[model samples]
Target: MDNWNILLESTNDGFTIATVLEVPDCQIRDETKEGAVEKVQQLLQKRLDKAEIIKIPTPIQPSTLENPVMRFAGIFRDDPDFIEIMKEIRAEREQDSDL
Candidate 1:
């Protein structure tokens, strides 16, 4: 059996919005949270009735621990000039590009 996690949010207009965690674009809105969840489940069932689920195995890759560049992740964390440098970089990026 598959379980779907539903997230509920209350709106200012006295309505509830429901979204399924595992399903993309599976959102429902109703007067009650339970009603939205139920409606989304029904819609998922309708889709499942006409589709098939398949799994594709991906090839295993080498571990990142052996990579030489992995040690520089936080190389500039202690640099006091990093923030000013980053600000200058961001200001440059915001300007019009010549390309």
Candidate 2:
């Protein structure tokens, strides 16, 4: 999962700031807050679609070598603790499925 750090600043109309990818240097922004968000979503979707069609470079891994979540946690995926929590939940689900 990809996450962005959105810095909203109050303006005459509303808030505004650049939406940057937490991992890579990719970023985009719009004058309008809502419009900026929508545009970013659209841009992300386009990139995702294009990524599906092209060969992209793999992201860097974390120091921990548990799973992909741990490998890229806090960088590409998200918070390490949250990722581990989700992993535990998934494990429970899989275990429940077998029963």
Candidate 3:
């Protein structure tokens, strides 16, 4: 299992995060939470061709200081867990087709 570190920063407009995937050479910085996850997936797919390795990244916990509207936007639009779950289901269905 490989672990990745991520940080979420707040701005006047919205929130963004940078994912520290690799040390220096192969790190990916995804501004948004969901984007960071997609970036990690892309990195792994590039590095490892077909080996199944469990990947865990530090989640971007929401901040209470953020505006309610911004927080709501983050909750509904940038929910990485929700997106990932859908992706897993889609992938499972695709694999089942080959059986």
**Candidate with best lDDT:** 1
Residue-level lDDT of model 3, residues 4-69, one tens digit each, is: 654444445554444443533444455566776677567755767755557899766567456767
Model 2, residue 4: distance off in Å is: 5.5
lDDT of 2 by residue, 4-82 (tens): 5654454665546545545243445567778777766676667677665447898766545457566454573667887
Q: Candidates' TM-scores? A: 0.60, 0.35, 0.29
Q: Considering every candidate listed, which one attains the maximal TM-score? A: 1
Candidate order (TM-score): 1, 2, 3
Residue 57 Cα positional deviation in candidate 2, in Å, after optimal superposition: 14
- Number of clashing residue pairs in every model? 0, 2, 0
TM-score, structure 1 vs. true: 0.60
Between candidates 2 and 3, name the one with more favorable lDDT.
Answer: 2
Number of clashes found in candidate 2: 2
- lDDT, candidate 2, residue 5? 67
Q: Tell me the deviation in Å of residue 45 in model 1.
A: 0.7
Query: Residue 71 deviation, candidate 2, in Å?
Result: 26
Instruction: Please identify model 1 stretches exceeding 4 Å from their true place.
Output: 64-99
lDDT of 2: 0.64
Please write out the lDDT profile of model 1 over residues 1-99, one tens digit for every residue.
Answer: 798898889999999988888786888899998899899898888878998999999876667446778778789988879978998988888784743
Ranking by lDDT: 1, 2, 3
Q: Each prediction's Cα lDDT score? A: 0.85, 0.64, 0.62
